[model samples]
Target chain A: MRKKGLSLVTALSILSALVWLAGLAWVLQDQFFADNINRQAETLKPDTAQQQKEDSSGKTLQIAAIGDSLTRGTGDPDGKGYIGYLKEDLAKKTKKRIELTNSAIKGQTSVQLLKQIQQPQIKRQIKNADVILLTIGGNDLFRGGQALEELESKTINKTEDVYLSNLKAIYKKIRMLNKNGIIYHVGLYNPFSDMQDSKTTSSIVRKWNYDSANAAAAQPNIIYVPTFDLFELNVNDYLYSDHFHPNKQGYQLIGERTASLIHFREEDQK
Target chain B: MNKLVHNELLKLFRKKRLFVIILIIAALVPLFTYAQYQEVKTTREKLGNVDWRTQLQQEIVDTQNRLSSSRMQDDWRKYLKIRLAQQQYYLDHNINPQAPGAPTFMRVFVENSIDLLLPLLVMVVAADLVSSEASGGTIKLLLTRPVKRWRILLSKYLALILSVSFIVTASAVLSYAISGVVFGYGGWGMPLLTGFSTSGEELVTNTVHLIPQWQYILMEFGLVWFVCLVVGTLTFMLSVLLRSTAAVMGIMLAALIAGAILSNMVSSWESAKYLFMVNLSLTDYISGMATPIEGMSLGFSLIVLLVWAIGGLVVSFAVFTKKDVY
Candidate 1:
């Protein structure tokens, strides 16, 4: 009886071991096969060796603009957003051509943009750029707009001064990194221009533009373009039916005005 | 009592039962590790030239498209939730879930649970644990000793419990040791995605917070032993319940196989939750990969399994302690 029991154990033990081995084999599929995607994002910082490929003069001008929903094709029917209009306008006016890279993620702030710009892939492009057009610090201002039911007409201003300082710091840092670059600090557009508190928020918005212009003025090759006039008090002419982003006409007008502004700058530089 | 427990242990090791457990560990450990190693190697080779974030974003978009294209309306939302979460997580953290996360030891220890093996190992030696002695008429000689019948049974039970615990610990430790050989020993500090959810709210799926993978293994083994203990106890019960050892083994085996099959097939029937076998593979349901019979939560499944186990123990003790040892 003992020998028979022992024999049964031996045979069963072998079978059990085989099955257990199979189960273990099934579970460890990831370690041997799965890709290390995380390391890929971090390993490649801006390759400094690629820094020698500079054009020295005006090659094809590469422009990068970033911002919130307006820049993210949020309110655009065709989904090209402002970058497309800006590109068409610039191409039509300059007729020389430009490379536009729109890296604008929806609902991003300046702090986020700064971090994004520091990424190796983006930093490489920014280094070779002739112009950097950016629309930012809007989401930071009107973040409470999402809670529109609870807080409307009430401006979030006190902490905004710090926001502006952060914005200044980002611009200053970018200027230091990329010398001889023209900075187009695209000012805010009043989507809520019809509101009674629109004028007060407009100054708050203008102060950012004014502060940005001053900050840009203090740094060489930085220019602030005031776009508030194109949208404020004439809400109907520019804004979409949603009263958030601008319509095609509104975008075209802004594009045309921006193209004109760049033309004047080119003439001034020449 | 201690001598008997030790005697039981010695007797256990003297046979193939202990060797089977060791064999399982030896075979499974390296296999699990190598599988993990292969995964990393394949990943390394595929990502040999590709950019990580773009690849990750593309994967997310691909998965999103796949989810959007197929799946019925009811299944669509769940698939979308998974896709949406991946996209949000990718945009926020720049990670691709379909890509590699951790080494083999951590993956095996945490994700794919070894719930089936323990009860199975128990079932191997368990059928003939006591009844085979009676069937071969060796009980007459064994009982001739000063050791009482209940004492003998108690010793066997204790011995069985000790062996079960040993098998559990061995399986888990071997999994870690073997996987470490292939994947490297980096799992100690690594974070794992232990994400589980009921409704829409995101649960912190970080595999680190709730418990270590080893503890999860231990808990799993504990539940396995408890379930197997019930199996062993019932087999031991049947050894007394019937005169034929073959009949006892066959009945228990059939019950287990039927339970496994019925758990899957006997769906929509709410009462199927009470079946002990339905909850045997408890980890799958606990991780929310599959649902327990209607209205069954992890806690609910645990209670059901425990009750069946304890109830089995009661029947085994009652029947075995009072059996005619003719």
Candidate 2:
């Protein structure tokens, strides 16, 4: 019996050795010699397209947030930003499960965001979103506080024109992807509102917000949510140590406002 | 020669090292599967019923956010940049790089284990192959046989090869069988992208191509097998040199653990790439992860490991044939 067992084990080991040898040879053939094969043309069909269609009836509230650092929760110590707090608020208000996808990159400007939404996965996320939360124009206007230092109207005008056009394109793309999803375009706040040149920066920010709000108004199901007033009263308290981004209290206030808008809409729908 | 190899196999089996190795794999696979399952569950809970695309998208965004931070190390930034681009490529192709299934689990399991866990397991079997026989004074009886010394050594090496193959296959089968219970037994035909090469921080996709997951896993297992064989060969060499099995195991253990540590910090120490332990992660190249050191490619790692294995084999034969035995 022991001899028989030994033979059986030997046979199995020999067989696996041959199998691994073949695998090694195949690696050499596939990784090195397959360059002549036309590989770039083989496009993969989106596997999730059918899966997405099948699961829409479950009624989970899909919240897709996009754009710059604010949406990404940059200044908030918890890294939840307004969107995280907004998620918490909405969770408290609604019985439905809130599914949130924050595809926000810090320091992303409007042009970069326009490019980001063009990605297939981002497009798919937008398509499935029941409510879209957007925060942009901060990096375009602020340039990480660089704009505040220079305050050059000509350069700012150039940036704003490019930004407004990109914003219009982004809005058009989101609307095209999802006709019914409510777009809450979170407006920018003047971080330098308490500074010595508060008048110049405040007017620049207000004009930026007004123009962005106009763009939001032009699109269907898009609401321009104002955050200018939230930080305007106590800018120092709301601003993070960087003097640029919002602190936790500031993000919480923004979250509450966005959540309230979403909350009442959920109530109205019910 | 075949009968001699058969004799060596009998000895190896009698020791039950193969059985013990398989048992270890079987015991650990479920642990990893549970950990992986919990990770998937937590991600699902966080994202709420989203598809793998959203999960992958979130990862890409998170990497991008990390890259944007100024406080990150330069090499880390480069790694993230390359990974972000690769994730983007996977997203663009509509292929879910992490589709859930037994095959996917097996791939992840092997990829992670190739560098250290698998090598250590191979070490456990190989460390004592010749040293134990020498320490036990069985070398005198074995060498007293009429067979040529090289032939006997070759048979023992063949048996070691067979056992290495057995251990790798056991890991593959056990991980699949155990993880399949939780992750399901599908995704073999899932399409995946490969051939993503990095030039500095940039991901060069000109040569990128699509291959099914099964072929990808096969190729990766091939790389894993090669890595294990090289590590096994080095351990076998150590076994032949030292009379004490403990000494052989200790040296191999220290070198392997050091390799694991060095791969993390060796981005600045470029020449460290030539070490066999650093090259043991041959599977990483097949999967297109950033090389621990720049200029280390699949070809480079394969060549380095081959040279080391050949060197080990040469030393084992030379010293085993000429060494004085009491």
Candidate 3:
């Protein structure tokens, strides 16, 4: 009986070890044999027939917005950032049903956003968009207002160069994925216009916007929408309590300008 | 050899401490399940009338807000980024961010079980495995049996390994059974996605694996079992070196706790990654939780743990075979 028990114990130990080993192997297999779906260089062309039909029938106009906190609806008490208000504005202007898939995450910089756009879900959203809205470079430029306060022109210039290249890469990648969608790259506004170093901060923001707008102009079908003028006169009225993000009124002003731009081509078609 | 292992197993089971360990595990599961239930209640209340996508967006904003604060650490910021990416993934896919259920509770339990408490319990058994015999004068009787000292020590070590395996499995099983009663025995077939992020880098959201809940649990158990084996082996070595069970247990407990504390405190210190204590959390890497140190990969941690386990085994075997019994 004792001999039988000893063998039973040994067999059980071996069995348990084998089971655990098998589990470890199975889980590790995914890491070792990962699929190359993300790396595949295939571009998904937007279906023209569907677009033409939607254009004719005034069907749902799919809009995908990808970027940082400004695109994520932060600081607005209603939590509907510019994208939410943009959807409402677009819905009011056109008979087409507006379907907006906002894939913007808060605190994301240009490099992070570039990586986010590569995700399969975001790719799918981008593939189906009639218009792709973006709001980046805020985190890249502002860096939580620390850079604005310090006022290092050389450091700001260096950071802007890296951001512009990242922006260029982002625009290229987006166009590669969806060749026909109109890409509206939203320009930055001066959140520190009310601050002590408002003049220097404004100039730096203006230069960054100018370079970014020029980058947008270089790409076909990518339009750069300026917002510096919107907050130039009433920065406090538009900014939230946090002073970083826009309040509801601020997002409304942005939404109105974006809506007018979006409506321009459709009104031309009409 | 088998009889020696059998006898060691019998002696281990005869200890009341083993039963107390089971009792403690049994009691903790309900408390954790209740806490999970409370969390779900509060989340549901907080998210009332709001869609999951909107909720996820708000959660991302909250995380970002916390991250912007100067008090937050770099490790926490990295972890929040991964969490934000995960919530974004779920939002994009329209999957509800984890509602409290048996599977969710079990997943949390498994993730948290590998911490100091579980290792401490495993060490309790290991710290006494060899030392208890020496303290009780049973080593002389065992030596009189004609079996080689190496064989005798090997049997005790095997018994400790077996006990560690049982303890880990038992914890998993008990957590599931108890949580199943409260939340229902469902979600075994639900999909669980894990995303691994490189140290200090943005979360690689695209590299997610959608394994079933059962497979995730199995893999978690496997990872925890390896950690337990390392803890048990190291404690067994300490048991052999120190004749007093209390001394072995105290030292092992202190080391395990210190490892957990150090992993949290000195996560930025690159050399902390090489410490065996810091590498005990293999589940974090596999579950796609942010690693303590930047750049510490699953493979790197496994190597670190393997080196420690082997070194401990070699030291234990060498000392046991050569040391005088008297």
Name the candidate that leads on DockQ: 2
Error of 2 at B58 (Å): 1.5
What TM-scores do the predictions have?
A: 0.51, 0.94, 0.66
Error of 1 at B183 (Å): 0.9
Candidate 1 positional error at A196, Å: 48
Pick out the ten consecutive residues of candidate 1 chain B with the lowest summed lDDT: B202-211
> What TM-score would candidate 1 get against the native?
0.51
Could you say which candidate leads in lDDT? 2
**Candidate 1 Cα errors over 4 Å, as ranges:** A1-270, B43-63, B70-113, B146-148, B193-231, B242-249, B255-267, B285-288, B292-294
Candidates ranked by TM-score, best first? 2, 3, 1
Query: What fraction of the reference interface contacts is present in each model, in order?
Result: 0.00, 0.71, 0.20
Please give, for residues B1-326, the per-residue lDDT of candidate 2 as tens digits.
99999999888888988889999999999999999999888988877655787788889999998888899888888888888888887787777777789999999999999989999999988999899999999999999989888898899899999989889899999999999999999999988777777888888877677788898888888888999999999999999999999999999999999999999888889899899888888777777889899998888889999999999999999999999889
DockQ result, candidate 1 = 0.03
Q: Which stretch of 10 consecutive residues in model 2 chain B shows the poorest summed lDDT?
A: B45-54
Q: What's the C-alpha lDDT at position A104 in model 2?
A: 92
**iRMSD for each candidate structure, in the order shown:** 11.5, 1.9, 6.8
lDDT of 1 by residue, A5-98 (tens): 5545434434544444443343233222324423333443334564443544554666766555566555667766667777776776564447
- In model 3, the Cα lDDT at residue B223 comes to 81
